[model samples]
Target: MSWGLAVLQHALRQPGCPLCRLQREAEARYLENLLWENVNDPATREQWAAGLGFCARHAWQLQRLEARRYGDGLGNAILYEDLLQRVIPVLEAMAREPAMDPLPLHRRLAHVLRLPRSGDPEGIPGLQGRARCRVCRLGEETARAYAEWLVEGLGDAEVRARYAASDGLCLPHLRMTLICARTRAPQALADLAGDAVRRLQRLLGALREYIRKHDWNYRHEPMSPEERRSWIRVVAFFVGEGEGDGSLDDRGG
Candidate 1:
């Protein structure tokens, strides 16, 4: 088996969503690689410039991982210093530009009321980073590729069994997996879909049990582990794994 698939199969034995876990690992790997090897590479810097040095989540993640892993923030400093240098000049130029006079009160009221704008109002300034975050892009590409692999992999009984042993794919990953399976391998999509449905049923049941047990009538009943985590697990599945949450290490990071 390919290394990724092997790793994915192993992940099937673990908790939470495999796709989410792998995606986080993929992003962390990219960030770690950047800090260790490519922080100063011209092409890497060019990509960073285009993205304006990462999205806020990843920008800080880069710094945090740099400090946590390396005991320093030198790499982040280099990247942001370059970005700040590019931005300060733009800010200074904006400061130098003549400011337009405020609109009349009636015109301001009109603008607020959604009438035509006045004074040739300009857009927010400074360099617009049209390029999406490289880390986000990589995460997406990795997830989709994994989704495809998962659908294709499901053809094997062993692979399907391995999948059945876990919490199954998240909604986003399931959609991507279904899409890939529909176009490329339609035979086994139902299995993955059924798995998702059954998992959802259990998740819903756990959530309901959790709510029921919260009532004073049922408060004496013991909470199962699944019941305990169903609320956050539901949120994780809905919002995706690491999109906003933080983490640390191979399991999360």
Candidate 2:
């Protein structure tokens, strides 16, 4: 099997949404790789600078991962310090902007008519970077690749059966898969959609059983493990599987 197909198949054997699990693992691996190897690489540093460091989620995630896994913050410190060094000049320029624009309306017009500000700072890059977060881009591209793989892989009866046996793709990934299916693998749409419908039906049954068991009279009845977690699964379906995943914004700022 292709590596991606193997990844999808293996993910299906695990708990929760396969795509979400893959994304989380992918992000961890990426950060670990950076900390273990690339933190000081010139090309890596250039990417960090362009990204202005990670988005809030990943910036903190880096720290958390470092502390929890390696108990060493050296790589994170180096990265943040470098990013800060690059960032200071931008904020300083933005701070200087108000002073440069201090002219009254008539004066500003006159100055504009004369010439552009002589010492305007080179494109004042901001905290709000035009560049997408490196981590976020990796997450997105990673998710997209896996989504396409899932959709196309479903063509195999064995892959389809494996997908059906698992918690299945989360809603966001379902959409991504559908998009991929609509264009590239129209035949697989039914396979994925049918699997989704079946899973949703199962969740609905479990949730209803869970709710019924909450009634005063039925409260004494024991709940199945599935029923107990049904509502949470529903919520996860709508909101995604993890923290900082609410938005599908490409820039992830």
Q: Candidate 2 — which residues are off by over 4 angstroms?
A: 94-125, 243-253
Candidate 1 regions with alpha-carbon error over 4 angstroms:
98-127, 243-253
> What's the C-alpha lDDT at position 219 in model 1?
97
- For candidate 2, write residues 145-207 as lDDT tens digits: 999888878889999888878877789988888998997787799888887898899989999
Checking candidate 1 for backbone clashes, the offending pairs are none
lDDT of each: 0.75, 0.76
Q: Clashing pairs in model 2?
A: none
